[model samples]
Target: MSKVPDRFLGYAFCVGDVLLELDMDFHIISADGAIKNTLGAVNREQSFLDLLTESGRGLIESSVKMLTGANRLGPFVISVGQEGLAKTEFAVFLAKLPTAEDRIYMVLSKPYRLGKSDSKNAPAQKTEDKKREFFNRLEGLFEGNPDAAENMLVTVLEASAGQQLDDEKRLDIERYLQSFSVGGAHATQIADDKFAVVHDKTTPKKEAADIAAELARATGVTLKGATIDAAEAKLSETDSMRALIFSLQSFASGNEGFAVDQIQKNCSTLIGETTERVRAFREVLDEGRFSLVFQPIVDLKKATTHHFEALTRFELPPIIKTQWEMIRFAEDIGLIDEFDYAVVNLAIAKIRKMLKKGGSPGIAVNLSGRSLSNQGFIFELMSLLRGNKDLKQYLSLEITESAKIHDLDLLSEILDEIRGIGFKVYLDDFGAGAAGFQYLKKLKVDALKIDGAYIKDALTSKEDRAFLRSMVTLCKDLEIVTVGEWVETQEHANLLREMGVDYGQGYFFGKPSPNFLVAPTAAAS
Candidate 1:
């Protein structure tokens, strides 16, 4: 096996992870640790890109041009081919060795599956007998319904650069447009001085035109309305999706092309690609092909690791939007409950193994609010947690995802029961949602994982700093612990600790890793 050079030690990797030395053209020059077996039937002429799944190939292929000693790419998880374990997924990272002009180092860690697990799951069976229905209720425009408009009413309003944009004015227009009472009557600023309002199936052409004219007068902007009816235009499912993309680009770029069929790519790519990805996502959950990475949440006062939040990572096939998109899609398609159960199982299993090794480590797993809202799924999840009551002390739930949660009263009661059994609950993404304060008022959580947005801006903006101070005060008054996210620098850590944020989680603490990385304070001692 090829040895890792001394120059690349600044970047870290596990001992058994597959590493490779590749030339400027990305051809493998040297191999180390399972690369041969992982790729299977490897050749001297084959580039490192050949082994990667589609998404991985594109990311690495594009990102290497800017790679330097100070910068590294990824630790991003993606699918890769492996002998027997065809479904093998790896956490991939690459860095430039300072002196090696013709070479770069690539590291691939088996983050998801172990001996029995593979990166690619068995192909999902396509059966005509099984019937299914899916709802992608895209009422808004770019995802604007990314500008994914698929058969939605789009109104573009162009504003002159008048004395800068008034937030109050923008909010007024937004609120008015949203008052249409249609699902996803969403308004977005696609570009500077350009705003797009998207409405779903219920939006009437006459009503939209009236609103557009009224809004153009009110806001003093040029307003235009356009719609691409897939059925009306005799477009296919794929073409409709493409039309949305073209329309969004045209509007954003200050161009005008209401007729979409001419610009729409005449290929069956969109529908086929979406179908393939959805199938791949299903296979992932069905085959249990996901993995967990632990990022330390440190107790700021003692400067020790309070616990590690087990963030779920996916090893999906090429050409997907994002990991989160897949997860959100799972929730939409009624598959998140299964994925959530799998996560809880994995978290507890890892925690249990840690206890056996005489290491009293704690792991927090995220449970989506959408899943918790499901009565049956929550009951099943509660039963599983209750069954493994012993691991309750080691395993906690970081309740995130406030979007789908409707019955706060029931959710609060459910959380109280979970906490009643000794498991601490942390409200994830606190202060990021409209109902954050409402959730805080109702749900009895032990801690708050403060949203990264506020934490990121705290050092730069006084208003944000005031917000942090207020949040800390609120948590203090409630006697709840506070965890600040996106804490990347010593400055961030210092300020958060000074502000009395109880815990800190970010790259400053440590990044998510396969194994439990010790807290910085713990490491120093």
Candidate 2:
């Protein structure tokens, strides 16, 4: 690499700013006085990556890999200085050096200043902030005692269509929920498309049903709702809340078609198992007692592994025989996030090791709806992966059809943010849920996993086969890849390939294996 031009250096030095010269490997060969002062002797002859946080490193790494020209690296916010010391916020920027193809120049800007808030946007931001505050407050209302004398009934309402509810309709829904606010009953907008009503056991079932109907009638919007009464639930306060969350989610997704009594009964079953389930969940976490197996998704034409989907297996007591049962229990008890985090971390760690050894097929992990809804958890996850972002190219996140996305806009924003970080997002179980093709329109995703039910029954069921073929055609038109799930036979594989499906994942390819090296090479398990 050639040295930076004298004219550029002179200008950079004159600006009295932090500047450095870096090679393709990101090792700094020279540094200005500002950088020397800021870094205190470690400014030169080191990779600039050493100065960044994990997420910053990931962002820069990705940007650097994709560097085409004099690209700006970041206005990345960071707290600089040694740990436990007074730190300063700095925004770092990097540009590929024009003089040398394999070198770059960097500048650091300090002390972030806020720009003028747009008058129109200020109110929206405030409203969203207030909504978050209200959500937290409502969650706190049940914190003190699980066995309180009176039970609380939590009902959540969401629009059955559209990305958002208009201001007037939104207000009417909120007001209706509020009108039921007598004694312990209160309501709040929990999401852009979601509203919640919390009341004590005293509220009648008929009253709850009538209010839901009235809200839909008044707003002229079809709304879905789920009501869970804590008094009837056999769970602790925390577990009960999760039950309510999932119940609401189930309703919104059009998955739970049961009456209110059945819904409560189901939640009660989940609650009753909480203590034992929680103990088992924690034991798995504490002991690192879970294993992940990778199932290859084969490309029919190429006959090579495009990527592997990581499936987790827990070493639980004999009573818990199936993985799905354990996962459902984990979901019911609010431990799904922890469980997912553990599984993803393990999967990523294994992938990193595998990459170091050899090979580069991508891996996709299933992310629960609960995890997606929790913004804090999502950010932390991104931060964790930011340092090792090159792994992102081979990583994907699959959002299941059963995962209830109450706020389409929020989910879209989250998906876009994830994609921006260099990972692909696949819609799992597409065409099986109420949203169906509608989900694809609202949320732009890289691929869709055709609902397994359709694939499994397609051979004998003409309707299922037609749906599968149509979905494949639609996806091809949209330039989205389609993967046939539960493809357990040669006939299924051939049928999917004939329909132009890009990938196949099922027992037909190979069963999942903890050791990828030992995984089967045959097309059929």
Candidate 3:
């Protein structure tokens, strides 16, 4: 706590938005507003910066250096410290009082009310959905997808531009730049002015610079920026995620190659072990040793199979991994896309065969969101599916939210194209992620599979049941079907049906087996 000017105190008191006072070290001195209701309990001992996620922290840290004359910090579509909200964006405004230069003031504003217009009767929604789903999806993504681990080239580019453009145009350009993906690598905006590109090991340093240059031009201003490359770094086995994130933060701060050392530290064992696993995994993909299992999603009203979801099962010796564990490993090694293509091809072939039997039940094959991020993969998948467009009725695509899709708008467009070909698309594990609401807004899907966790808890927890009922009502309003998973008993099914879930799938229904009646895919469980 420090002395503050009376005029500044008066202004801070009158400000209706969430406000915070921070020392020069960015430690909280004071706080006001309903922040505790959303973000969490305010602890004055904590660094004000600690409240922010990595990217959000990076944005502030980057801006701090240029704050000498600037008072206003952002209207950046900045993600706040809060998790699991329907909308993650907050419009941030930061200022430094002329008389009290030792303290920085921040205000956070957003459309935060849940299903309300700020009336007297309106109440706040529970936070578990936002918190649990955020951590769950992040854990799912952090574990990696089905692929081998390899050295990667991570490059950070910090630019000076966009001051001349309007906020919407600037955000649009940022989104466009963030869409840059090569193979398994994707670009993420660490700071409003900084973009970090994670590229394949084969990507040259010069090539990474060129990517920065191209994106820099998209800012619609004469921007000059420096690119730093953390070339050929092996993330540490024990703390790979922390090391990776810290490295990005350092890069955003214009630190030298110090970022690489964090990841490279104690990574030798990881390198040797992963090399062998990568080899074994590649062989599995090549050998075509996987089998297909079909789990029927039953329509609640009709009590019949609406469609069957195709799942993968691996058959191998020694090293054992669950379906998702293998998928994450594959994603880590950057070979999941190849595995995805193989599965889709097999699915098409099977659909063609089923069509040969005169009357065919439709099959939905899971496609990793990571693969969809790659334009090359999307183009190839579209080409392959278009070639077998006649099987569109018998085949559907279920988007597995295994990885974040960088260009969601592009994906929505592609999904529309696929649906135009008469293939239904379903979003998997809906409401199991922080971005589900954003996803539902952007994507036009025929159906969504409610996360199994929600379904498992629905019968016991009134909160869970309430959320499901509300979700089901929203889906019905949108004219979209809903599927509940992990249904183990008749009671569960009945309750879900009463809540207006259109379909259901679980062990109570027949479990998945090699009922595809054909040779299975070349890769993965």
Which candidate has the highest TM-score of all? 2
lDDT of 1: 0.65
Candidates' C-alpha lDDT:
0.65, 0.66, 0.61
| Candidate 2 residue pairs in backbone clash | 58-386
Cα-based TM-score, every candidate? 0.51, 0.56, 0.52
What's the lDDT for residue 178 in model 3?
A: 32
* Model 1: residues with Cα > 4 Å off, grouped in runs: 1-272, 402-404
Query: lDDT tens digits, residues 114-168, model 1?
Result: 3323324533212110111001222111222221223434444555444355655
Clashes of each: 15, 1, 14
Show model 3 residue runs off by greater than 4 Å: 1-265, 317-320, 357-359, 516-525
Model 2 C-alpha lDDT per residue in residues 1-525, reported as the tens digit of each score? 235567777775553356677878878787764654566555456677776655445445544543335334343344445334444555555566555668777665553333323222334433444454444444444544453314556666667666467776776777556544321124666556766675545444324466567776777777766565656663335645555455544443345453344554465564455445566677888799998888888887676777889888888766577888888767654677787888878878888887788866688999877677777778877786676688888889998635445667788888898888888999888877555667888888999998889989888999988888789888988999899899898898888888899999888778888755322434333
Error of 2 at 475 (Å): 1.0
RMSD to the true structure for each prediction, in A, is 24.6, 18.9, 19.4
> lDDT of candidate 2 vs native?
0.66
Worst 10-residue lDDT window for candidate 3 reads: 516-525
Position 125, candidate 2: lDDT: 37
